[model samples]
Target: MSQEIRGHPQALIDAEKGTLDPLPGSLSHSKDVKPPPSDVLLSSKEKDALVTTTTQEVILSAKPTASSVPKSKRVVSRWTLWNLWFNTYRKFFTFTFGLNMIGLVLAASGHFPYGVKYSGTIVVANFNFAILMRNEVFGRFLYLFVNTCFAKWPPLWFRLGCTSVLQHLGGIHSGCALSGVIWLLFKVVNNFRKLNVTHDAVLVMGVITNLTVMISALSAFPWVRNTHHNVFERHHRFVGWLGLICTWVFVILGDTYDPVTRSWNLSGVDLIHHQDFWFTMGMTIFIALPWFFVREVPIDIELPSPKVAIIRFKRGMQQGLLGRISRSSIMEYHAFGIVSEGRHAKYHYMIAGVQGDFTRGLVQNPPKTIWTRELKFAGVSNTSTLYKRGIRICTGTGIGAALSTCLQSPDWYLIWIGSEQEKTFGPTISRLIHDNIEPERLTLWDSKARGGRPDTMKLLKEAYHYWDAEVVFITSNYIGNSEIMQGCKEAGIPCFGTLWDF
Candidate 1:
């Protein structure tokens, strides 16, 4: 047999060293004999077989001996930690909050003239921006604009930066929301101090609005969101709606009533002329936009295993979108990554792993109809068009997020690491991968069959160089995401991982 094989060169080298054991269905190798190119197709005869075809995959059944173990010592320096700390998210937050702080200092020093009169305008302006940042319609438009204008035309660093910026727009949203609340507090206090011009009704509404906004913001704290999700959702959403109502009252009262005359002006023109009124209107429209798309849609649920539920929706979606579903229009809303072949396909799917109450309910009592918005939101993967070629690395359910990009675009490579992939995810997901993904562009590491997880960093580095990929997108749990991100940072490889803060 010739030493040169069509498969991954590293696999051939490992075989030559007698350090790797092939899985039962995989092609076996010996010192003097090399496997043929066609032999890379793993047999489908095995029980619960993981069907894969390709040369670049590593499917091992036995654990490597101590002497054969690959050394994957990660060295992260303080510089790398600092770079990670000052990420795109923090930068957006800092820039926005810093500008607000400067304005606040000016107002506190009494340098900003008419600070009391124009304070409402400032508050509403901040809120308008904050709401816009979170608006699904605006978000989709931004992603579409970026992908259309700069996809594969810009330099690698520039493209990576664009994706980072898109992913972290929530930072701007957070900073503006907190700043708006602070400005509202200042406005309310100043109105109370200026007793002559401020009407009592306006002051009361301001106070109530301030409290509602504060409560809504507090409910969104990470601890509250992670530990008591239902509480967070209710308080954040319902209280936010109450805040908006109070804000409308405050704006109308403040704009229409003349504090100097201690009387109300019922004229509609004066209310329409106020800057704060228009700003509030813009934000209200943004806040209510998604709700306009709300509908009760029929769904088909396939329960492959107790661990996961595959949900199929009517129309196919483009790659890199996420959909939020709920049992009712006002309750238990959860966001999941979407998997669709393309817009032309008959349907798009969401992989609902049994992670929480809503998802668990899907497996326990599947619903025939569910509440969802017609317009799905965009995610970082939506920026996949920016790169010429890239790698999508995900673990377990993360595959739900990572699979569509690879399926839709042949230039993208996929590396899915999981245990009992076919059995846990079922035929729907299995068929999608098998039918769309070519063997040369895939690496399915079944940790259950392999005895343990492979060195993922080593696998990623190998793929990054061999595939000549410009960027890497990772979707994994906290620890796995952290480890892979750290490795990528140290290697100076441009990459993006799942964002937990949002």
Candidate 2:
């Protein structure tokens, strides 16, 4: 007699005698099994059981097939062309405004003398200067400016443009060129005892050269504004030496000649031209005295290998009206070589002298304990569990400090947060990422990308969930530090931050 199977079709067979696995042909036969005509079909509950079983089997079979499929290709999002145009417009507006201020100052000072006829001329000139400031938009405006100003002399423009480009190449090149010219002039005057170069002439030349150097150095301010402070300082030092050379050339040439006699006589300036000679002699001696008196003394200090030693006075107590006779001297030291390798390390020392009686000399100090604490925290090892690892979130300048800490510990995961057009942390981020840091390990939370700071918090929570972050390190300069820390506390996570003591 034939019998109908109930529940799961596979369950109807005897466990000891029957095989759970289906034969190849039997598997195809199950798919062929169908309900009878509607009037004679099984009850609703029985139909429901059969449908559920078939669905489960289909899903289980599809799982293996889906697992073998490759991941979808990722598409990079590109900024719209209009966004680039808007940035160009904003930069143009800023440049034009600055030039307008300069034009107004010149016109008020009678340099431009603005009238109805000159009104259009003034606007045109201001606009041209603004265009010249932007490299991408400068070529046409620069050509027009040169053509108009020099009476359409193409050669003059060529020379001026080339000189301008070279001058902007770097401060070191400009400084060296200026100093070399002045030094050559000084040597020529000293060697030629027959021709007399007047002291006033030398002084005027020195002043003009110094002023030119100063203006050139100041012109770089706009470009250097976006650069690192260390780069600016290096440029300043180069320009400063040029100024000192100009001063030296004037003093040497002026003191060696006799103005009254109209001849070069290097008899100590006292025998031939007494008064004028003594004046020049005194000035030159005064300028050279500091070189002799000021000396760099080395001090033992425990810190980084390339640390700078700064000796600052305790305010009030110097020669000049600026109340800062402070004399500074830098002593640079070079290490022998690197351990196991041949590389060498270098160190610099800067010492300043306060011209006062009965004062004690201070030595270089050690690094603060807080610095050590931060470094230690940054060196924490990575872990599989989020609770055991630390998360670093930063904004503004704190990004650099945080990134430096992050790079030292590669095993740990990092969550970096930033704001729109806020590049204060860009240097740190770029450095870490360029070193091959994992993308999955980093979650960049941008405020602008998420609407605002409130939205940033929501996204931060989502990132935390994605990364299973335990410790949160915030590096923002904004005043909402307390709010962020509170949120982390509420989520049962500990937070560390810069700009806030907590």
Give Cα-based local distance difference scores for all models: 0.75, 0.31
Worst 10-residue lDDT window, candidate 2: 1-10
Reference-based lDDT, residue 431, model 1 = 81
> Which ranges of candidate 1 are over 4 A from the true structure?
1-75
| Number of the top-ranking candidate, with lDDT as the measure | 1
Worst 10 residues of 1 by lDDT: 1-10
Candidate 1 clash pair list: none
Per-residue lDDT of candidate 1, residues 95-133 (tens digit): 997898789879978888666569999998888888787
Assess the local accuracy of residue 46 in candidate 2 as a C-alpha lDDT between 0 and 100: 47
lDDT, residue 94, candidate 1: 87
Whole-model lDDT, candidate 2? 0.31
